[model samples]
Target: MRAVIQRTFETALFVDGEEISRIPSGLTVFLAVCRGDTEVQADYFARKVARLRVFRDENDKMNRSILDAGGEILLVSQFSLAGTLGKGSGNRPDFGHAELPERARELYERVRDKLREEGLTVKTGVFGAHMYIEQKQDGPLSFIFEC
Candidate 1:
């Protein structure tokens, strides 16, 4: 599993011109399940993302986790994150590095539920849907997790 996480003041997802998920203040995470990913990878990812200390602290250090800040999570499925294509990850057709749709969807749903179970208010984008993910924060810190 791989994820590109961005801290945002707000985020939302829309599919077929209808809003599907939203968060007031939290991280907007774009995740992809690689072809070899399994439940163990998903579990490790959830724990790492949950403990990330990107939020600032009283001492001006990166000392606050999302759980500590009481923030939510906007999880979006982006299988393209795994696809590399011929010209790298640029504009081109995906070369089949990503997991199959059915498997990816299952893993994505699992990650979302697992995160929510960890006590964060987790919202999710529709799996396998053409959706738009909007992050409403500029200059936010971003991180990518591989697990």
Candidate 2:
């Protein structure tokens, strides 16, 4: 599993120019399920996101997790994160590492459900839809989580 997490002041999703989900302030997560990824990996990412301390605390240090900062999550499924490039590969990207859509969706939903179970509001983009995202980043703060 691989994920790109960004801290945002606000984030919104649009499909076919129609507004979908939005979060006023929180994290926007772009998740990808790689071939051979399991439920255990999915669960691990969820727990990490819930407790990862990326928010500023009273000391102006990045010491607060989403659970302490009080915010929502905008989870997006992006299989391209599993694509391979470089070395033997040429300009064209190879998606052989990406999980098939069916299994990928299952693991994606598992992460979403687990996040909600952690007691934080969670929103999502349409699973297989082509979405346009608008995000106001809290900073240049972004992290990649993989396992």
Candidate 3:
């Protein structure tokens, strides 16, 4: 499993130019599942995402977590993250490492439901659709995680 986590002051997803989901002082997660990844990886990733110290605290230090700040979240599936880097080595990008869409969706749903149960406001982009994200980044902070 892999995810690109961006800390934003605010963010929103649009579908057909209509906002479908939005968040404040939270994270926008672009998630990708690998062919061999299990639900346990999804569970671990979600917990780490919630506790990641990407937000600045009262001391102006990168110490506060999303959970600490009562932040919201928006998750979007992106299989491209699993693209093998062969194209740079004179071959086309190989996406065979990516999990099938059907399984990815199931794992994503598991992550979403688990996070939601923790009392965070969680939103999501439509699966398998082109998504537009408007992000107001308070700190212009971003990170990547893989497991």
Candidate 4:
């Protein structure tokens, strides 16, 4: 599994030109399930995302996890993250490494639910829908995780 995470003051998810979910202040996570990814990878990913200390603390140091910072999570599935670029590929994305949609959606939901079980509010985009995301990034901070 792979994820691109961003700290945001506000974030919203839109599909078919309709807003479906939003968060006040939290992390916007774009997640992808790669070929061979299993529940083990899902478990590791959820734990890491819950514990990642990207939020600033009292002294203005980046020492607080989202759990400590008190925020929600906007989880969006983005299979394209698993796409590969290389020679003889005609400059097109090769999704050969991305998990099939069925299993990928399962793992994506697992990650989302696990994060919620860790005590953070979690909102999600429609699984397979093309989504439009609007986010006011805090510190423009972003991080990537893979497992």
Instruction: Evaluate residue 79 in candidate 2 and report its C-alpha lDDT on the 0 to 100 scale.
Output: 82
Summarize candidate 1's per-residue lDDT along 8-83 as a digit string, tens digits: 9988789988999889988889999999889988988888889988888898888999989878999988877886
Using all chains and alpha carbons, the TM-scores for the candidates as numbered come to 0.91, 0.98, 0.92, 0.97
Q: Find the candidate with the highest lDDT and give its number.
A: 2
* Regions of candidate 4 where Cα sits further than 4 Å from its true position: none
Candidate 2 residue lDDT tens string, 83-130: 889688888998899999999999999999999999989999999899
Give the clashing pairs for model 3.
Answer: none
Give the C-alpha lDDT of model 4.
0.93
- Provide C-alpha RMSD values for all models, in order: 2.0, 0.7, 1.6, 0.8
RMSD from true fold, candidate 1: 2.0
Candidate order by decreasing lDDT? 2, 4, 3, 1
- Clash list (residue pairs), candidate 2: none
State each model's CA lDDT, in order: 0.85, 0.95, 0.87, 0.93
Which regions of candidate 3 deviate over 4 angstroms? 87-91
Which of the two, 2 or 3, has more lDDT?
2
Best by TM-score: 2
At residue 65, candidate 3 shows an lDDT of 83
**Runs in model 1 with CA error above 4 Å?**
85-93
lDDT assessment of candidate 3:
0.87
Give the per-residue lDDT digits (tens) of candidate 4, residues 1-147: 888999999999999999999999989999999999999889889989999999999999999999999999999999899988888788799989999999999999999889989998999999999999899999999998888
